[model samples]
Target: MAADPASLTDRRLLSDDLLATVRGRAAIHDRENSFFADDLADLAGSGYLGAMVPSPLGGAGLTLREAVHEQSRLAGAAPATALAVNMHHVWVGAARYLHERGDDTLDWLLTEAAAGEVFGFGYSEAGNDLVLLGSRTEARPDGAGGFTFHGRKIFTSNSPGWTRLGVMGLDSTTDPDDPRIVHAFITRDAGGFEILDDWDTLGMRASQSCTTVLDGAHAPAERVMRRIAPGPSLDPYVLGIFTSFEVLLASVYTGIADRALALAVETVGRRTSMKSGTTYSQDPDIRRRIASAALAMDGVWLQIDQVAGEIDSEPDGRADRGAGWFRATAGLKVRATETARYVVDEAIRCSGGSTYFNRSELGRLYRDVLAGIFHPSDDESAHALVAQSLLGPVEA
Candidate 1:
């Protein structure tokens, strides 16, 4: 019999079972470079997708901190699966946060998620590094209380499974002098979008975050959520996105580091040094490498937990609006991703030649962790944001 989703109230129990089932299928999906359809089904069926929805709404009602911790645990089992699912979680978690702030605008999002609708983010575009600050996609008004989006979105995760896509586009037609970003939700059944089979990549292969082309894709007026000026505005939507995305993204990478360290420890504890006839775990050099990785990972995990806890405790989400929150989140993203990359490298080093094989977990982790560097808040952008926050904006 399948496990009961409600019984998964204990996060650790859910994670242990999730790891067992999802991890077993991870290698197969990775080898085929296919989406984790089975994993998605398990997560959705187990109510993991609606983890942030209120229990009264027939969902798990998990706090951001708890949800992120679960995400970290899941990633340790299957990084790609966890990463792809993070998109859906971000939407639901954002909606919950907004609702807590007394904003009913995103109530429909929570309702839809509770009803088993999967939400995927489509805010990213090729050559568009400004993130939510700008968009290349055009949101042309349809006069019938709707918008027709025309452009392309890259790295759209959960591409094969998302029923509703949360997307943003620029609407310069309203006022050429002052363009605003129009955020809306587009249904998959809408006629104008296409998902390209172009996700083949060096890492996180199972995510299948394919390129999405939007040619006059329509979002009904009712689905239209927020419209705010480009660049750092104090919009609630922007704050929610930044808070949820950065924290969840950091959690995912942190989980990768956690798993990598565990694998290294296991390998080191078992490998006997031919020269000394003792296990490498006792070797000072090997021990030091593992300890260093552990300490670094612990620091990142603490930051993630702290930030997530603060966000969860905020009644109105106002705590996440300040420049301090931005700096902290940007820093968190950089530190978590970079630390995961470093830890994965150390894992490979300590595991020796065996870990270099394609079948090795550490080998897969090395590639999966690389995807972290390319996500929003890349090292350079993150550093610039942090610097600007501390010293004030640089004079152009």
Candidate 2:
């Protein structure tokens, strides 16, 4: 029998609850279309997709740290779900940002999102690398004085099922091209666009990284969320959104490592090692490696908690490299992303031939954990930015 929704909600903190959700849905998701469906439903039913919204909007009003915990736990159980759910949080953040400016669309979207409307990001493009700042998509002013978006976005996660998307593009009329002036619009309706059905990959397959085409899609001015020239209602917490986002991503991978290590321990504890009668977990060398992974996860968790506290305390100030909090977030993101790769690799090796089987949960997790290293914050340019802060700035 399927578990009760209330029972699922009550054990939000229990690892077994999370594992059961992932395990129950894993096989179904292994298919092409159904992979993300069950996970998205779980996200909606559990209220995790709306965890970022404020209480005033009928959400739980969870803090950044609390959101981090939820993302970490959920992502560890199912990486694809984590990726999809995180996008929902991103939408919630976007909605809250616009709502402070009295944007009614955002208000409406946030309300619907709280009721389980999923959102996605449509930014990455085919020709333009995210490292270089430019969007192939252009927003042209229609003869009627409105804007129409045109161009294709690649690697859009949760494409077909997602209810809303934040499409980023450049305005066609800017005299001098400036990267800072990039704009975003929330689009709903699947028409005027095609969803590319080519997301097959080695890891995070359930992310549904499909491509979307926009052919003269009408986007009114009211739909645009201008980053620059904001009014008084713009909350200062807006600046720290990226930091919080990175922290949440870091937490997920760290939790993946934690879960992988636990599984490795359980698997090896009952088996005999080739070199000795004792189990692999009993060996000092294997024990130390597990300990190392555990220590890395613990350290990253503490750093995430610390940075989240700082964001909460400084919700209305300029965030900078000088601020130990921001710097710590950067450092932690770098460490956690890299460490998760190591932890997962070791977990697979420790599990030996068994990890290769599709039936073993660790095999899927091993593939998913590897995805953390290439995520947005894990990009080389991001690390370079952090490093440049320590070094001198480069002049244009």
Candidate 3:
């Protein structure tokens, strides 16, 4: 008889041996400004890639709450690697999130993910603040139960190894006034797309998130995940995508903050203050900053963990997924990312000038943490979402 799936833990899926290799290679990948190919291979081989696919479907059988914990741990070891792989998890998690709530539109995702078909997120576009609600890309129907996409996608992470890409485009062929946003997972062999090798950045260099140009990329009718309305509507697929993306995105930053705090603690213990005649750990001011960061982090973890648990427990999408749900999800992303930036700043301030060097881990973290501000549910949008939730939409 097969072993019980419930008995499987994230630690088993993410073996200690593989994590050590991933941690060791983080600096190398960053220094080279390259994608984590080895890391991806190891993760895929170790079953970490299919962690959310469900046990019966040949996965490690982890829940979003459990995956959140595992993602935090992975991010702690290598932030860019964790983030790059997080895209894959986002789609799988969304599929699982939707499936649990009686929406089986993307159930094929579980089977594909289990069989080692890497997934990448290809929705981000330059200056497109309407993120996910509308698309700058065009999705013209092919008349044969398919559509061809034409547009450019920026920050296409996991570009080096992804076999399947989840992208979106606007389809005006149906009632131009009320267009639809086509969501689909297109395979690499689908052709009509190009991956531009340009991903050098200030930080998180290891992610190697290149630009993708889709001249006529196509997705078959079977693979078209969703076709949501143009404006904001509480579609089940939309909710799942937003919730999964934000929660998992927050987990990466949370891990960055966690690692930065640990490094700061170690630094304080090692550094001897010339004026105080004692280790910085004993200094009142240094201790205070660390404590403050810790306090803020408590809320960060609570927000992320609670949301993940809520999704797992209340897996019904057809009812009660209101503004409050979106509000909490968006708020968590904003808070967690902002708190991560704060923690990293405190860590650097307490660690001393040595950490300012280019090779120093703190310096890398300081830069990596800044990238959080750029992700969706940005400070502006998140604040607006919160306000809109509290007070109904403003009059025209």
Candidate 4:
């Protein structure tokens, strides 16, 4: 018989071995701008795709905190692979959150994941700054009880491997004056969706986050999960996505910072200055910079740990929901991304000109860190959310 799918011991062993394998291939994947196909296959086979599902469902039964830590670990080996896999985790985490709250609406999601079905996030739009609050995609009810989506989605990670795509669209057929956004899951076998071959970019190239065009892509009635008014709703599903996505995204970047700092330490300890005949590790300025970066990273890691732990401990998932949780998660995203950018820059500065080469791991990290700025809850949005949380919303 196969090992129990919920075994944390087995999960860790598999992740460790997977990380080792992915780490060696990261540079090559980045250089070629190819997806981490092997990484995805191994993760799926190892039952990692269902890590957030409960043990009874054949998953690892990991809490959000545990899953985020695992993500950070995976990111240290291959940031793109970890980021891509995060989409699947987001869905599973959301399902677990809902299930714990007595809502079994997303139980099917867990079952599908347990059966090795991969899920991808499809909420991003090219110019939609009000993410989740609005959408350019059209969702028309089929009268037969289903819906069809028509529009394009960008930054669809796991595009090449996703068996299901979770998407949202505006449903205005009932009342255009008061349109509502509908969220649903559609399988890859469903016709009318196209994945464009245009994912080349500055960093995280292995993610293969291509653009997707949905021309009347249908989502059956059963898969239509939520329908809510747009613009900062306190719905549980919305909160679940916000909580999981922001935390996991932060974890990925934090892992990048950790790896960059480790590389800096290795370089400084190995390189000797000709004039001083001493390693850079002994240089006071270099030491100070590294110390500062370490301190910043420590702060980010602590915040992630605290927030995730709090959520897990709260049976109702209420301790970290609504405006306060949103503010905290947004702040974490901004801080973690900015900290990673700073750490990677410092690592490059301390390591010398060689780090500027395209093939340099540090260089890839530097570029990859920049992508964080484009993710939701960006610096401006985060600050705005924080300000609104402290003070009232902007006066009419």
In Å, residue 138's CA in model 3 sits off its true spot by 0.3
Q: Which stretches of candidate 4 lie over 4 Å from their true place?
A: 1-14, 316-321
Q: What does candidate 1 score on TM?
A: 0.95
Cα deviation at 194, candidate 1, in Å, is: 1.0
Per-residue lDDT of 1-396 in model 1, one digit per residue for the tens? Answer: 112224444643255676799999988899899899999988888888888898877778888877877887788889999999999998998888788888888989898898899999999999998998999999998987689999999999989999999999999988899888999999998769999999999889898899999999999999999878899876767888888999999989988888898889999999999999999999999989988998897788778877887887778544554657777788889899999999999999999998778899899999999999998888888888887877889999
Q: Model 4, range 1-396, lDDT digits (tens) per residue?
A: 111224433345245677889899999999999999999988888888988899898788888877877888788889999999998998998888788888898999998898999999999998898898899999999987679999999999989999999999999996889899999988899778999999989998999999999998999899999988888888879878888899989999988888898899999999999978999999999999889888888788788888887767767545755568788888888989998999989998899888889978888888888999999989998888888878878999
Per-residue lDDT of model 3, residues 170-243, tens digit only: 99996688788999878998788999989989998898889999999989889887788887878878888899
Q: Which residue window of length 10 is worst by lDDT in model 4?
A: 1-10
**In lDDT terms, how accurate is model 1?**
0.87
Estimate the TM-score of every prediction. 0.95, 0.84, 0.95, 0.95
Per-residue lDDT value at 139 in model 4: 96
lDDT of 2 by residue, 47-130 (tens): 776776777887776666666666777766777767766766766765664454355547766777788877777766865644
Candidate 2: regions farther than 4 A off: 1-19, 31-34, 94-108, 127-133, 143-145, 174-180, 227-241, 316-330
Q: Which pairs clash in model 2?
A: 29-35
